[model samples]
Target: MAKIPKVPKTVLPKPPRQAVPPPPPYVPLRARPVRPQRTNLPNQQSPPHPSAQETPIAPPGTTRSDRLKQVWDERPRVSDIKRLTPEQLSAPTHQNRMNKWRQWTLFICGMSAFGMGLYGMQIYVSLTTAPDENAVPDDLSDRFDKEADGYDEKVSMAETMLFLNSRRKALMQKVRGHVLEVAVGTGRNTPYYPTKQCATVTLLDSSAPMLEVAKRKWKETHMEYFSRVFFKHQSAVDPITPPYGAQDGYDTVVQTMGLCSTNEPVKLLHSLEAATKEEDGQILLLEHGKSHYEWLNSFLDRTAPNHALTHGCWWNKDIGKIVEESGLEVVDMKRYNFGTTWWVELKPRKGMRKQLEDAAKEEVEVAVQKSWSWWSFWR
Candidate 1:
């Protein structure tokens, strides 16, 4: 084994030490020079820096949360309220227009309130006061006679309001073949009847004066079709014979505003059915009655007694119920004015009833035959 030679040890010289400077002389905080703080004049404010505008600088000692509260508290108080002068008030600017609108609104509100008050008072009086024995006539026909002379004039306003002439036109346009118009008051529907479509038009009413007015109206408007028009003075509930032209039966029987005045509306409807042909005859009716809504129905019921005395109509009658009880089949039915006004087309159900009975009889016969066959097999 060879012995390893030892490496010679090398020594490096050390660098000289540098001098250390003495610490700064101590000075008391109170002895230090004070910097002058910049302040804005009372009337003049300094322009905000661009950075400060985005992020506001808080006071030296204030915390972030306290800075927000302090900023809110130091905010300047200013009012934007303004008063208008007479010139500005009367000017035709937006504000002036707004004022006018407000005035009109107030006027309308006041007028509506006044009207409502009057209506409420009327309802109260009608409900509270005992009706006089002589207030209404026992024979309502007499009331019609008395009103016949001015009947057209009296109802013109309401007719216009309700657009009844348009309704009459619509109904009369549907009239075909021989026509019978019951409760013809002042012939309001006469002008609307199609001369060519109707083979004959018979006007029937209980009130003689009303009949006279109807005749006059027919003579005035439909004199050209005088041969086709006839006037009959009788109650609608009375048994009516078919006119000379319509020997089988009236093809169309029309009654407008009639059921309201009648004591026996169901009887009237039945009588109308009897007068009409059983196969193809139609009964057309336009009437005002109890509304679908209970509130309106209540108003009608509350006002009915007094209204009947003056108008000779029980306005609260359930026209639908009356028609249902009459046993006539409704062909078409429509309502307007919140279901208070009804336009109905009805036909006799005799043919339908016979058909149903025949069908039932055939079914019974088939069942009986089946049972007899089963018994025979068992035997």
Candidate 2:
């Protein structure tokens, strides 16, 4: 038994010693987690973590300024800049971002207030002193009389804007033969009439005082070329069929920036057609209408009330559509000033009379269904 035990002991080598894992990673006691700094605005972001290389541990700095200088110096050099991502390039720094947010918030609040004010004003105008059945309101006659004396001078202030020199020269030179000018304010079109070819002239306006100013303008110009010059104080909105119409009607109907403020622009167009002779008669217009540009149109809309009060002009009228609706054939039309200014040449179509009559009847029926008490638009 002793021999067997010795043999086993001699054969077996010591079992390989086991290797122990390195002691668990040394972890120092963690300080209380720093609560993030609160910001007044929403979406505030956390500060970026600086890499160990970027973070300069000031060696017992002598002063706070010196410590800050050392920290800034640790910032990445220019050679390392190419490693930056697009987010870093596109994003504003925290302070700049906060400032931009504040400015946008203020701007949005201001625009909201302005929009609300415009809505309130539109509602107020709709409720008070709506227009009547008569296309030309009675008060408008009195208002024109008041504006008559200084009308030319006041309108002249816009000369540079209107290109009055070139437009008037082009528009007025077209009128020839017995001419009828409807709603011819202050005879602005008189000087443009063909000096040699105009046989007779008839000036019509709703305001007697305005007619007087036109008469004065004609006299001042000394237009001896005309066989006769007649001044009529009549609303062009009325039917131009009989005694009220020009004695011999007209060979040309001239409208210069007239129908923008008219109570019934379509009606006035019908009357102009009625007053024009069936043969060789046409309408020439130099007018301002809605601008094609949205920005300019929005500006005009915002200042609608001021323009309505100052000049009897509608800044956003659709003159082109009105001409089409009137059933007049447009021989030629030129748009200038971003389509805000219209130079139109019109002639009577064969079936215009029936179209206008039907339109009048439909207008009556429309009024019966839903009343229209003021000018066409909000202004």
Candidate 3:
């Protein structure tokens, strides 16, 4: 047992020493405490910020003066805008004076030419057209018969020049329900009638030829409404009988330029009044008469004789006065073209229609009595 213990003690080797990490490299302690270096984790670096001293980079090839000018132009200003007055805009100048002078000269020349042409036209018509001493109220039928063929063509230019078609349209647009158009020459107002509004339209004219022309026009323009229209070859001065369906009275009585042709305009208006519904019936008249101006009236008066001889129209008559004398209530009245053209809307007075009817009835009774007496005497 002694030999075994000595042998184990001699065989054991010395143990190896363990390694120690070096102390962190010497970092000198700062006099003032300094911020410790930030320890960044993997892939977590921050971007650098711009400094206040940075300047804007100019565009290539642009001058400093050019850049300054661009900045100046883009800057906003409140006082740059201005508005000019009419006086400043229309300041007198040589060119402006010349233009005004030329305009005035042309206007005067044009007016003079118009006057001369009007005088010449009157002369030409008076000389060319045959005048009949009998072409008064009773013989107007004959005169119109002769004039019917070329009448529309003869008057179209004057009507257009005066814009008379528009005036007729304005007047006829007011017509509604059962309508009676007296002195419907060639049916110039035919196309303007609202066919859907009028239940019946009676066209009355003195001349058979004129009625025929009106019939043809109505057929051509409003053939679908044929059943609604009727033509009467009779004078307006005579009592107007309502068409077959409208036996009571016409809703509207229209006469354009007729007062100028009739010998007794007031009588014509009275007849119209008699033919309309007493309560709500309207009488529409578009006529040419003495102008408001005395100078124009004098001109019309001077030319009236020849004009009447040629056209059988006494255009110098005072239509307003005639309407007033007819005793109809004036609803609306307007004048155009220096008061020579008139548009009148009138309503029948309450008892005026009855008075006219009684007078007419008495006259008819007297005529029948006279005829009976004459027949008895012959027997």
Candidate 4:
């Protein structure tokens, strides 16, 4: 083991050096020939092919004519562009624009109509349920006064003013001696009264609050005529008997937008006739009546029960017949707004001054006639 370890101390052979290849030599580029300068002319242009000097020469045995022929066959030729007809050019744009405008207009009109219909429906619902004496308690008078004071703010006062103004002059001229204004709400028409021509006006209303408001307004505005104006808180049916007294009967009784809500229009008319001096007194009425148009009448008839329930007013009362049956003569009846309303002037017939007394006496006769008719029917 000792002799083998001593023999291993030998030197290794040295490694050989590797050779690296040298980089290729750089050559200087030859200068190219300069092309002739071009003139700044609009019609002048260079050919699309390369110059002869810049092109490579073909090797021996190559055909140059075949390449030139192939290039010529591949070129595009110039041709005229076709034009559109005059009608075709103009029609499409104009028609498309018009159609778009028409569609927009129709859409806007339909929206407007729908909005108007909704507004009308709301108004119908509101007016049909408007409070009146027959339906509401006595406390409603205060509510009505509060409501009416704010009517302009709640509703369109401009339209209401215009409608009231239209009737002002007419009503003022028609008033005469012992004039009574029935259901004079807030007295919008009070300013229009002819104080000088009319001897006295008894403003009658069932609503004490409304009467109070009317009196206050009258005193505030026409304090001078306060003595001539009398405000009575009473129902329309409270019999024109003593204490109230019918000694000096009314000469002209006027009602505007009042009769429609009267609980018993016929009875009221008869009572009015009883309260008036024969032939001298008159009843002037301006009322919106049942429409004469078939469709409108049908609609009104259908809705009348609901209207009456809400408004405390009847829409289909035969007012003309009521006046006639009350022994009053219709002096004039004029239809307005396509027979949707009437301006009626009536008076007690001559010799019918004692109509109430006569009616009282004839009660037995009417009863006897009814009894006879019933007996005859059975026979």
lDDT of each: 0.79, 0.71, 0.79, 0.64
How good is model 3 by TM-score?
Answer: 0.65
Scanning candidate 2 in windows of ten residues, the lowest lDDT window is 48-57
What is candidate 2's TM-score against the reference?
0.55
Off by over 4 Å in 1: 1-138, 351-379
lDDT by residue for model 1 (90-208), tens? 54443444655568779988976776686678778877873654565555666787899987877775676577789999998988999999998888998898889988888999999
- TM-score against truth, every candidate: 0.60, 0.55, 0.65, 0.54
- At residue 76, candidate 4 shows an lDDT of 30
Which predicted model would earn the best TM-score? Answer: 3
Kindly indicate the candidate among 1 and 4 with the higher lDDT: 1
- Tens digits of lDDT, candidate 4, 46-81: 432223134444457767897777545534322211
In terms of TM-score, how similar is model 4 to the real structure? 0.54
State the RMSD for candidate 3.
26.0
Lowest summed-lDDT stretch of 10 residues in model 1? Answer: 47-56
Model 3 agreement with the true structure over 189-290: per-residue lDDT tens digits: 998998888999999988898889999999999999998888898778777788777776899999998987877778888888889998788989899998
| Ten-residue region with minimum lDDT total, candidate 3 | 46-55
